[model samples]
Target: MFRTLVQNVPAVADTSDTSDTSDTADVAVIGGGMSGMATALRLQSAGLSTVVLEAHGHAGGCAGYYRKRGFSFDVGATTLVDFAPGGVGAELLDSVGIAPLNAQELTGYRAHLPDREVVLHRDQSAWHAERLRMLGDSERHRRFWALLDRLAQTFWQASRAGVRLPVRGPADALHDLRAVGLSGVPLARHLNRTLGDALRSHSLRDDAALVGLLGMLVEDTVHTGVDDAPLINAALGVTIRGAGLSRHVGGMHGFWRALVTHYRGLGGRLRVGCQVSQVVGGPGHYRLTTRHSTLHARRVVCALPAARTAAICAGLPVATRLQTFLERDAQALGGACVVFLGVPEEEVAAQELTHHQLLQAYDRPLGEGNNMFVSVSASGDTLSAPPGHRAVMISTHTELSGWAGLDPAAYEQRKKEIGERLVGYARRAYPALGERAVIAQTGTPRSYQRFGFRPDGAVGGPRQRLGNTNQHAVPHDLGGPGLWLVGDSTWPGLGTVACVLGSRIVAEGMLREKGFAR
Candidate 1:
């Protein structure tokens, strides 16, 4: 069971004043998501005057959550991973003097593949047993697991030590080279390789069931099927149980509030409902135009998606090409469609369940109706559900363009149809979900655009394929003098862990530029 997220600390005074509309700071971070908050808080703690301008009413971005009819649903980010002691999340929380949230340890999720059902256990022995049972005790399976285990270990260890790809500048390049050491050498060979490459190497590429299973897992995590998912990231994605995945006690919304509390308690200024319209200055000195006022800062960290970032910097001459590149990348990313449900507890009393569940049907396309990642809150968790109800959040990838160019009525009808289809499919896993299961709400890419201010609700970061891995991925340093990008769209790619790591990378680069450390 997870610990309760209960931290009672005295509130720090709002040190930086925005009431006078001074609109000046040492550093200004755009988009108060996970990355933006981390960057601003770390810089403020480092003695830099920082302010966070977020378009949304709350922080957490994709990690935000909401309540409806007494049921709480996690909007996008459902779990906290890689948060064990000394892990990336742990280290970051430690630095901020904030304690880790109470989380329930996941014993791996149950994968309902097309042909078979398998429980991917967190424990090595259990996983080995399951692998042997489903994949058979063959040398190919052993070799594949061996390679993934090694690659995952190296990738995670390097991340824990503060090493990320897509070096920002000379200082970042130097830091990366040093962080690589000998452990990262093995990872280099797989930089350009994909899960398919490893499968082919083991002669298991033709195993339909194995390929289907991994494809489901990899596609959900890296936004690429096994055929194209880079080995380094896919390896980490497949073996994530070793790192740890947990559900926050009160849902992700609680986590967001906790993060905001910690940041504000540190006297860091956070201004929600402030949208950055444009970026109009150069390195060393930049001016950001918000809906209400214009703000200036010496350094800026942008945590918005590439499209939004590009729009914000459209006024800069050097950023024209950068904006174009970001636009292209944004178009290439997968869109998200989420469905929330509230079911009576008695409806599914006979079945066993995990905190997270993934099911994929191989016949359909990669996104669309082929796959779904679902999360269900434990019964009696009043924070997320009523006493006799269970809250469920389901999501899957969709083509961003599909939601565009539709009339308002058509869009609403399409959303309704998709929601019904998804709910019908979900009942396959939870058979009790008949009319008794209430369809609380459904959200599409358009919903994300309205709330997150993203162009297409583009999420899950960049696609981690053959040509987009490691050094080839979108960079943290945008080559602008004082401009830096953090979050899923760059460097370490997507996920909460990647965002935190990216923030650290940006923070370190900023400190170095300030002559804090090498």
Candidate 2:
């Protein structure tokens, strides 16, 4: 379907528009994260001249990587979901004609709770048996699991089939309904529900072990606790192990390098360190103001977080629209605390898998290192670290507000405490994780704000809730001509796979608007 979308469109033109307009293109992508890169490449392949303006010097916004002292660490998100054969990621790669990813297929990770360790296997039957053996084996447990498998299977397939959601109009409503098919009609009842609702229906709401496990998984994927996690969204979250989770052989560093190479090879323009400060004018005459220069494009796709998008498009009609959601997401916007360590391979080799999710205590609140995830690079992936060393990234969610208004001394003190706490928590999986680290550093919301250029360092979109996700999600078009939004902030929500799905929706819409498609 995508192979011929842009085959007849025109390529980028030579810019003789003077220093005032140093760059110009048929489409301009305002962020170089997964969503922006995907959309730009799709549009570029469709025959439109495209330029991607990234504030950061490198690619992959939250999913990006960094190097220090011969060690490379993924900044956020360790695994790629549903990228294997017939999955959304595979479809995207096929659509763009990029070679399939060289990722290490993972069996799954071990979840370390305060009292028990559960192995979440990728094999469906194995996971079914394991969950029954570990979490609960009652009929109610079976019913709950059955509901999740049903919803997850339904929606995951809809997404893979290119379902467009968060209906922006009558056309979208029809398109999405058809994409879902008649078989999925009954699943819509869950749209108004929460994961808690499902548990309640099964009379398992009080099951702390199960709730804690679900909470940890839900929070990581949807940025919300189980009670408030939208049912459909949570379904996809808890069952991702069954879908597939893989860490690139060289980690995100290798992933970004490959993506950028493919995009550039397609003749797409990538301007890093070029921050867009303002966007003015309208469709086919949009003006993007960057710190160093200005870029003009016929269309604009912003993959920025909502807050950053609001700031850059300050006075446009979309700014007001963005603000409404910004206020709704104000309390929901969260950040991350990451501890990157360059440790000896032995430290990580002791673990059964390269990834582990640790919940220090089921009763305690989730963040501030109580619940953390650890991702260690493959032992022989030399691109991530020195031959015998490995790069380890430990992350936990945090509300951005918690890190504000601190004195320098106080901030430093807190950063130390949280960083140490996370490292300590990670020890549950890799007992020797940080004992003899060659390099250890911590990052807070402020660190993300500084490096990722996100407003308040908001990492994921608003925590998925009944009112904030699914049919209520922020759509691609914000009532601005030629202005579009994609990324974690849009439909399908966070992670590599979600962003890629959003890219497909936005790219197709851009093409349709330009009459580049039927």
Candidate 3:
């Protein structure tokens, strides 16, 4: 059922610069994911010599893609929202000369609960109006909308101020406080509430549909439930209410390719396939020991996870703290996703599927097969199938801790069973899915580990619960002078936009500290 693998670009040259030219670089960014790439690009554009060391051959990390036959599949992420003009995400893309496609805007998400199915529209008025009309007037719905609006406004303001910078000590904390103080009262109030209390106080506790909605939001944002998450992080998802969802025209991989192109064009150096073995430090500089050679730089940004950062900084003072943070703060939430491609054109014609769909079995446990988020890369006008064929990607949240240490045969059996069950559940929404699938690929936690290098195949990094939501909770400070951290495990947490924003903030802080500020 699979076709030939197509090469998109020529192999990158091995950059094993062993000569000690006495030339110093401004910064060296480890990990070539969106966060690392964005940071390197921003620094280089400021005229600072930057080098991005990516273990993988291509850039984009989780945001990258691979091609099979004629189809391009986004292996890591698929959906994006809040890309409107002037938004940080949009501005970043625009600066890189990557424009959003004029594709059809998704109305909203469709929820398939065990009891019923509901289609969520992008228009707030329309969405609320429909809910009230169908479920009757409930004070819960009214209060929910009001809270959503308030939270959305506050988050929009905060995001506009630019992502917060890394804080080193009490002095940095005071600076951050001053910045927040200048923003005024609303910001303070918004950060003071927990998402759980917000929902319970509004009488939304008994509403299954409302719970499902908030649950999905929580899952996508924190990789956990609302009760365990902080109000500030949850508010980030609520704030995306009316912003139209977007996707790259070809696939998400197209977006990654565009970023690499822009970065290379700016005269930035990118070394791929060279694994960094150790990061050693001298009197005032740091050197990266890779398989081929060593790269010495004045400043280094550890853009990978805290665990991997610990591995690289073996001889550094912060190594112990980094390891602790990785164990406690960087614990992974287990989950797996399966991508289905090559469904014939005729089957897609019968089932009118859109670019996205959400399937749920309400009675099931939260981490089980209860909720499944699906996205189709088909044409905009038609939801079910791509222009001539059909492509579907489905994902569910599972605890990686539960699957660890299992025997190889048992692990394979579990994957096969889960894959079949998920496909069966999807068949209920699109009956034609049964006989139409021509290519099926199952990605277990092992697959994620193999491809993304996530330790336990944890797609989401560190749970955004109450105690771990603060600035210090993030391993950004590293407790050392020159070492820094940036990624999904850092402040602001998961999602492509959040990761990029966090990385930018770290880069800006480093620039300011090094006297490169405007």
Give the top-scoring candidate (lDDT): 2
lDDT, each prediction? 0.76, 0.84, 0.66
Question: Between the candidate structures 1 and 3, which one is better when assessed by lDDT?
Answer: 1
TM of each candidate vs. truth? 0.91, 0.95, 0.88
Candidate 1 residues lying further than 4 Å off, grouped into runs, are 1-20, 168-174, 327-331, 348-352, 515-518
The ten-residue window of minimal lDDT in model 3 covers 1-10
Ranking by lDDT: 2, 1, 3
Q: Where does candidate 2 stray beyond 4 Å?
A: 1-21, 514-518
Per-residue CA lDDT of model 2 for 1-518, tens digit only, reads 11111121112211211344466788999998989998998988887889888777667788887777677778887888889999988888888888988889899999998889899999988999999999999999998999999999998888888888788789888888887788998898889999998999899999988998999999999999888999989999898888799888678877877777888888998877678899988887889987667778878999999888888888788889987788887888889999989998888897768788888887789988877888888888997899999999899998777899999999999999998899988887877889999988988898788888878888887888988888778888874558899999988889888999999999988888854342
| Residue 68 C-alpha lDDT in model 2 | 70
lDDT of 3 at 394: 67
**How well does candidate 1 match the true structure, expressed as C-alpha RMSD?**
4.4
lDDT of 3 at 172: 62
- Residue 129 lDDT, candidate 1, scale 0-100: 89
The runs of at least 3 residues in candidate 3 whose Cα sits more than 4 Å from the true structure, single-residue gaps closed, are: 1-24, 94-105, 131-136, 165-192, 239-241, 282-284, 330-332, 349-353, 357-359, 380-387, 479-481, 515-518
